[model samples]
Target chain A: MIKTKKIHKEIETLITGAGTILISSHVDPDGDSLGSQLALRRYLVSLGKKVWIVNHGSIPSKYMFLPDIDRIVRIDNFKSEDRFDLAIILECPDPGRTGDVKHLIGANMPMINIDHHPDNSGYGKIAHLDSGASAVAEMLTEYFLEVGYKIDDPAATQLYTAIITDTGRFRFSSTTRKTMEVAGRLIELGADPRYISDNIYYSFSESTMRLIGKVFSKFELFDNGKICLMALDNDMMRLNDFNSADTEGMAEYTLFGRGVIVGGLLKEMGEGSTKISLRSRNSINVGEVAHRYGGGGHNNAAGFQIDLPLKAAQEKILKDLREIVNGTV
Target chain B: MIKTKKIHKEIETLITGAGTILISSHVDPDGDSLGSQLALRRYLVSLGKKVWIVNHGSIPSKYMFLPDIDRIVRIDNFKSEDRFDLAIILECPDPGRTGDVKHLIGANMPMINIDHHPDNSGYGKIAHLDSGASAVAEMLTEYFLEVGYKIDDPAATQLYTAIITDTGRFRFSSTTRKTMEVAGRLIELGADPRYISDNIYYSFSESTMRLIGKVFSKFELFDNGKICLMALDNDMMRLNDFNSADTEGMAEYTLFGRGVIVGGLLKEMGEGSTKISLRSRNSINVGEVAHRYGGGGHNNAAGFQIDLPLKAAQEKILKDLREIVNGTV
Candidate 1:
C-alpha cells in the first residue's frame, strides 16, 4: 500500500506540468502492452494533455476490435517533427524492448517507465515497475483510481483486455484477489467480459482450428507423463499456411495433461531452426531454461529459438528439461 | 441487496434449531454442484452439526482431490434408516431434479432449495433460489459472510472451485463485481485459484485430449457459418472406450468458432438413439430449442435425446436450428 501511494505520488509529480506526451510499448506488443498504452493515453488525453501513441510494432488484426485502436500510429508512420513534453514507456522492461521507438525519446524529455516484469531494469526518470501486478494496465488502473480519474467505457474495455489477456483469463498464478476485484469493477463500468473474451479467444479462423487439430495429434508424453512435447513440422506449417500468431499459446497445451509439469511446443521456423515455446504448471522454471538458450520470460511460460533441425532441437531441449525436472525433484 | 439480506435472515432462522442435516445436489453434479455441496457440508459440520451428503450420482474421479469427498454417499448407497432435522437440496431446479432421492424428503423434513437455475421451480419449503447468482456456491459464500461463518482453507478451496467452474473462469455474462469480490475473499482465505483451475480443467486424461482432437475433426459449419455441429458416433464411442462423462460439455466447443452462434454435439446413445447437447453464444436461445425437442435446460445450454439414427438426428436438429437462427436474424 505504501509503495502504491509512493508510485502515485511519483506519477503525479511527473505528469502535473507536462503538456504534450509521447507513448509507446514494447515491440511485438501483446494485449497487456497495447491495451495499457491505449488506456493510459485516453486518460492523459482526457486531462487535456496532447498524447501521441507511436507503438514500435503494429496491433494484431484480432485486437482491432478495441476502440480507437486505429489511432495508434506504427513506428514506420511516426513523424520526426512530433514534439512531446513527456514520454511514457509501457510494459517494456528495458529500452531495447521498445525497438526502433527508443530513437524517439530525446535526452531532455522526461520518461515514465511502467512495467510488470519481475526482472524490469528501471530506466526512466520515474519508474513504476511493480512486479506484483498481473499486467502493466493493472498498475495504471490503480493509479487512475487513486488520482481520481474517471475511466470511461472505452478505457475500461482496453484495460480489461490487458488484465484478461495477461492473466490468461484469470487462470495464471499472478491473478490475485485484487486482479478479480479490478476485473469486476471494469465489467461494472461497461467492459463486457463475454464480448471481450469472445473476440480474444473464440474468433479464430477455421484454418487455425485445423492447425490446432494437427498440432494436438502430434503431442507426445514423456518423463513418466510429467512432460508433454508437440511439434508443428515444416510440412504441417506449409499445409496450414501458418502465421506467427497461429502458434500463440500452443505450447500451453502440454500443461493440460494430468500431472504434466512442463509442456513444450516446437514450431518449425524453417531454415533448419525451430522456435520452442514452453509452459509449466508448477515450480519448474522454464524461463531459466529459455535464458540458457538465449531467451527469457516468466517462470511459468517462456520461449527460445534454436538453430537446429526440429528433431535435434526437440532432443536437446527435452534433455535440458529432463535434467531441470530431475534436479528440482 | 435487500433480497440477499432477506434470504440471510430466513436461513439463520431455519438453521438456528436444526441439528442433523441431510444435503444433496443434482444428479451428475459438475464442479459447481459438487463443490458447493461439499463447502456447505463442511460449514455445517464446523458448526457442530451432523451432516450427511447424499447425491443422486457418484462423484467424478477428477474431483476426488476435494477434501472429504469420500464422505459423500451415493443415492444407491444411502441407508433407509438415516434421518435429518433439515435437508438442503443444492443446485437442483426442483424436487424431481434430485432423481431417486426425492423419496428421502419426508413430509415433516423442511427443505432449503438453493439453486441458480433461471427456470428453477420454487418447490422447497424455504427456497433460497437466486437466479441472478452465477452458482449456488456464490450465494452460499454471501450467506456465510452474512451469518459470520469462518471459511476454512478447504471450504474456501471448494467454494472457489464452485465459482470458477460456474463462471467459466469469470468469462460468463452472469459474473459480476460481487462475484469477483467474493472470489478475491475466497483466495485470501487460502483458495489457490491455480490449483483449483488445474484440477477442474487441465487434469483431463490423455484420452480426453484425443477425444478433443477427434471432435475438432468432426466440426461441420452450417447456417452460413453461424452454426457448428460435431458428433461422436457409436463406432467412435466404442473405439474410444466411451464413458457417460466423456461427452460432457463437448457441445461448448462450437462457441469457439469465429461466427458460430449455436454449437451442437450429437452423441450416439446406442439402440437407434442419439443424444444432443447444444451451447449458444450471445442471445441464441438453445434451451427453448431443446424444449421443442422434449429436452430442458438453461437459455445458453440444453440437451435432449432423439430416438433416431445418428445421421437422421443430425439432419433433423440442423434443420430446426437453421430455422431458429433465420428467425432470430
Candidate 2:
C-alpha cells in the first residue's frame, strides 16, 4: 500500500534497464540506512546487474554482521573510474545528506530517492517518499513485493534488521499492523528475529559496559523528576576508549526512570563541544527543543551539538526543558 | 488456527456453567503469568461470571499498571469462606507450582489448567496444554477467538503484555508468524505496544539504577571470555535498599558481553545463602546446569539457590560451567 503504481513501475524499469547501479545513504549511517542499502545492493547483484555501495563514513562495528558489508565502499576509498548508469540514494532527505556522494550524482545519471522521513526534501528524478512508512526498508520491501522479486534469506535478514532498528524493535509509534505484517513476512522468509536481536543488542563490548555503568552512576533527576539527565564525561570516554557507537541508546536511559518525562544524555565530545541527545514521552516534543539548538529529529527522540562546556550546556538545556514541561502542564 | 475444537468447547462449557471462578498462577508470578490471569479474569467478569482472582505471591510493582490489578487477592489476605465453583490455574506446570494456592483447590471443584510449558503435568480435570503456543496468553487469545469473546482494551493490553514478556518482546525463538499475527490483532484491539514496552522494560527505579551500576561494576569475564559472572552483594543491596524486584534483568547483563557463552548472576540473599541465575547462548544448556544444582528452567535460562557462601557458590558454579563449555566445544 505504501508504493504508488507509477513510482514502483518506474523503479522496476530503471533497475531492469541499468547495467550498473550505485547505492548510498546519509552520513554516519545507522542500521536502517546500512541495512536498506546492503539489501538493495544484494538484490541487484543477484539479478546480474553490477552494483556498487558507496557511503560517506565507515560502517559501525555493530552493523558488520550484514552480509556483504565489506562490499560497501567508503567515500574516501571510492574511485572515479567506477561505472554506474543509475544511483539510488536511500533514506537521505536530500542529495547533500549523502555527504561526499552528492558529487558523484552527475547531471546525466538518473537518480532515485527512497525515503520515509516526514521532512524529506524530494530531490531525485523519481522520489519514492512514503512518510507514513516506518522505515526506508519498508519502502524497499514494498518495491520488491510490487516487482514480484523473490527475496532471499540474506536480503530478508538485512531488511528485517532495518525495520527492527528504525522502529525500535516495533516499539515506536510508527509501528502499525502493516509493519507487523511486513515483519511477519520477513520472518517467514528466513529472517531469524532472535539472531538479529542478539547480534545487534546483546553484543556489548567490555568497555561499552563500563561506559554504560558510568552513565548510570551519573544519572540525575531535575524539575521534580519531570526531567532526567546523564552525562558521559571526556575522561570516562577516554578511559574506556568508546565512541558514538558505544554510547548508542544511552539517552533513552532517562526515559526509564520513574516520573521522567524527558530523558537527556550529554556527551563531552572534547574542546568545548558537547553532544546532547533527548528523548521525550507523550506530547513533549524533544525535536522542537532540538530545533532550537540547531538540530532536528522526531517528536520523541532528537539530538544537537553545543559548542559550550558540558555544565553550561546542561544548564541551558535544562532551563528550556523545564519551560516545555511547565507550559505543557 | 491455533484453536482446537474440543479444548475450546470444553473451556466454553466450564466458564458458562461456573457462577464463580477462582484464578491463580505460579509463585513469583512474571508478566506472562500475571497478565494471562488478569486477562482471563477480565474476560470472564465481562460475561457476568463472579471472578475471585487469587495468587500465591504478590504481583511485582512493575505490573501494577494492569487494569484492576487491585482486584487480585493475595493468598495471605484470602479468607477461607470465599467460594468458587471453578478454579483456573494459568502457566503453572502442575498444581504445586501455584504455591500455597494448591491447598485451596478443593477436591470437589472443577479445575482447568492452561499452560504452554513443555513439562506441564496435566493436573487439572480439563488440561488445555498447548505446548506449541508461545504463552498461556496465546492459548487464551485462541480460546477467546474460538468462543467469539469480545476482548476489551484492558484484556487486550494484558494479553499483549503477556505475549511480549513471554517472547522477550518477540525476540525469542518462540516467536512465530502466528505469534506476530496474534500480537497484530491485539494491537488492533487497542493494545499500545510502545506504552507496554516502556512501562515494563524502561521504568527502573532510582535504587534499581544504582543496583544495576553495582552489578556492572562487579562484572567479570572468566575462561578466556567464554564465561561471564556478576555479583550483587548483600552489602550493596542493603546500602541501596534494593529488593528482589530491583534485580529483575540483572542476569541478562551477562549474556550481553562479547564472546560470553555462559552468563551468571550471583546474589547474596542472606547469611550463608546465595541465589544464582544462569543464562547461556546456543547449545550451552543453563537449565541442565541448574538442574544439577537442584533448580530447573528452560534451555537458556535457569536458576538455583545455594546454602554455601557467595564466594564458595560462585567457585563451584563456575567450575561446572567451565566443564560444560569444555565438553561442548
Winning model by lDDT: 2
The chain B TM-scores of all candidates, as shown, are 0.94, 0.95
- Give the Å shift of residue B132 in candidate 2: 2.6
- Best candidate, TM-score-wise? 1
Fnat of candidate 2, please? 0.63
RMSD per model, one decimal:
1.8, 2.0
lDDT string, candidate 1, A1-329, tens digits: 99889878888878878998988888777899878988998888888898888877667766888988987888898776858889999988887778898888898989999998988898989988888888998899889999988999999999999998888778888889899888888888889888898888888677777777666666899888888998899988888787765567567677878888888999888879999999887788999999998776789888888999999999999999898888887
What TM-score goes with each of the models?
0.96, 0.96
**Candidate topping DockQ:** 1
Residue B290's lDDT in candidate 1: 89
DockQ of candidate 1 (2 decimals) = 0.78
Q: Note the residue pairs that clash in candidate 1.
A: none
